[model samples]
Target: MGERLYLYGIFPAPGPQHLALTGLDNQPIDSHTIEEFTFLFSAAKQERYLASRRNLLGHERVLEAAMQAGFQTLLPLQFGLTTEAWEPVQQELLVPNRDRLKQLFAKLQGRREVSIKVMWEPDQELETLMRENEALRLERDRLQGKQLRMEEVIGIGQAIEQAMEARKLDIIQALRTALNPLAAEVIENEPMTSAMIYNAAYLISWDEEIAFGEQVEALDAQFEERLRIRYNSFTAPYNFSYLAQP
Candidate 1:
């Protein structure tokens, strides 16, 4: 099969720049300039580039290097994007969407994406919910002295599950309210696991990063006993980068 360019992302063209970065198959990372933008990509065979963990991590490594090199407005391409040649990338993607891309780049200048994930200990939250819920308390009391029927046990479990769901919603809303003001854009992602209450991405400007971090620390301190909060702030703006499917 013919070689294709595996795309990582696009950034402002850094004049005479060369990154000591490697991509898929340990290929040296490079770029192709088009007007004011430079596209980062590496050569790979189609089959090898499709969702392989090594290749995917290689893609991220290249983008991370670009970020370190101080390309402020980087737009990450979706994983597995490939084109037969640079001519088609310019003709199909760049030419057709130059103005829109320029606008997006300008808007994203001096900004970066941050991800937040919140998880709670299910047993702890369930115990707290049971204590606060009269129905759950009564149900537990009812079952205390007598043998519980299968349906009764299931009912109590279901009630706890429902309470957990509601609590998750409330916490997610509170998180959005607390963090939205510091972000240029907020993207709520699907929870990755049963214990995950919040999974979101924030596009935050450089000037506001300190404040944003402070707010997160405050929130963590506030909920330290009930929740586990984790964040990553130095990634490329993947959530806001919406290019047409190629």
Candidate 2:
């Protein structure tokens, strides 16, 4: 590849634009229009940009600026997306894929992704389980002084694990039941750690952001003693995109 264009995202226009936003290495961002939508870019020489903090922030700044530019539909390309020239992208990708992309914009317009991360302390839950389950308490008493057998130990560990999973599911179900109706779409991403009970993304419209937040707060208050429900709404809705091409 020769000189490249580090792509940030696409915006459907007739709305305002602020492409003057700086990108990776403080490169001035640029754009190319194909009918109603425009692709945002900047000069690049590297084959691939490393996932450093500065570089990632620069990439995100451009997309977030687009969000602030007053466009209802902003299709944020994934970080590190690049192309050698805009011609092929215009002729091959943009022109050919216009109708499909338009439909995508319709689905994405007026919406933003909201993330919810629910976590709990594993040791605390295990203590609760021990106090509540008589059989588990008996098993603990029986093993207190005897030679610890591998099979007996594994059985107790499995039982505790299953109970923890059930509890996690029940809490998640309650959250979903309350919040899913307010969202246009919901994605349950895999938990990143053992402490995580629910890791989810919701596609919420601008109109429903407040109502959605109130629901989250109520749920958090209800579960505050046992679980911590954290939410983030600042980042772009890239997770819910079909145009976030790498």
Candidate 3:
């Protein structure tokens, strides 16, 4: 049996070009052109493409290299995507979806995905909330006198939780307000950590990349003491590409 093709992404056809890139197991990366689209892939054994950290990183590395090579408008395939051979990709993926692919290629041209994550210093925020909340102070005083009943303790905990949720929501909303105008599309992701107020990905045009960065820098300076804003602007359009998947 032949080795499966590990699909990385699809890019606009650049005629014939060399990608000085390697994929899983150090296999040389190659491309197949179908019409105006080029599919980036590498040959690999099924076992080598398992959902291991190494394989996942290999998939991202290939896409990253493609992006760095000036393929700004690209669609990244999900990790672990493989085919028995290249023929199926053409008959099933390319031929059937040619029109849609072309449309997406035009729509996504000169654009890239950017991710922004916002986090607040939990200790400082919590301290400030506790110090300012009158109800919380009363509750703390009630608990200080003697051994607290279960309901009393539960009430205090609930208050803190509610305050945290409200703060997180406000922070997320403010961030979206500051960033949405600069993006063609916005996708909100779940927070990966308790300290994370928001995690969002923005589809930004290459022409507006500088403007977007400047906006982020402004927000960072505005919230420097309380919230930390971190961003990455060169990633493949993974969030937007899923909508184009067959």
Candidate 4:
């Protein structure tokens, strides 16, 4: 019988071996040779094949195994990738997709993905700040006094609205400046609370991950009194489009 190759996502050499421990058909692929690194893939006819949930889990398992093995992988065609035999996998996928795959691998080489979410929790201090703002407090006093006409009351309401808007802007600007050094790409999401501004960003790195985390933590600590933010990091799946094409 001919050898069947189970294709896992592509990666650089030194891939994980225990990946075979997580079976493809609930059976492991054959061992790898000393000279070449091997990944696993299931061989089924492409013409009638479907990417069932079972296949998706299998693929995820394969990638997770690679991560555990200390190797990063990019599954270019995430799901529904198939071949009838090892030769087809080598010829159709490994050969034709070789350049693209290599490019993606190069782009992601030594880089990790980090996510940051900035939120504000309403605290007593912020309320105190609002109360201390002379303009807003004065407006509240004027409205309560019942000494103003309708036009004057409208004016007071407008003044209070403007003051609140300024406060929000001031807080957002502070966070933007504080976060400038830590993020590669920053996206502002809807505010989490009346007091909190949301800034979500993805940071790319290989060596700077530790420094990046420390920086974010420092920011959190520094702003903990008025603003609170947190961050998380994860391994990115391989993608080809992230690279600029030649």
> What's the lDDT of the predicted structure labeled candidate 3?
0.82
What TM-score does structure 4 among the candidates reach? 0.55
| Comparing 3 and 4 on lDDT, the stronger one | 3
- CA lDDT, every model vs. true structure: 0.82, 0.81, 0.82, 0.57
Task: Give the TM-score ranking, best first.
Answer: 2, 3, 1, 4
* Root-mean-square deviation (CA) per prediction: 3.1, 2.7, 2.5, 7.0
Backbone atom clashes (below 3 Å) for every candidate: 0, 0, 0, 6
Model 4 misplacement above 4 A: 1-17, 20-65, 73-103, 122-126, 144-179, 182-196, 237-246
Reference-based TM-score of each model = 0.86, 0.89, 0.87, 0.55
| Cα lDDT of model 2 by residue, 193-238, tens digit | 9898789999998888899999999998988789888888767877
lDDT, candidate 4, 146-231, per-residue tens: 77888988887687667656766776676667655665545455655565556455545656767777777777777676656667
Give the 10-residue window scoring lowest on summed lDDT in candidate 2: 13-22
- Candidate 3: which pairs clash? none
- Runs of candidate 3 exceeding 4 Å displacement: 14-16, 45-48, 244-246
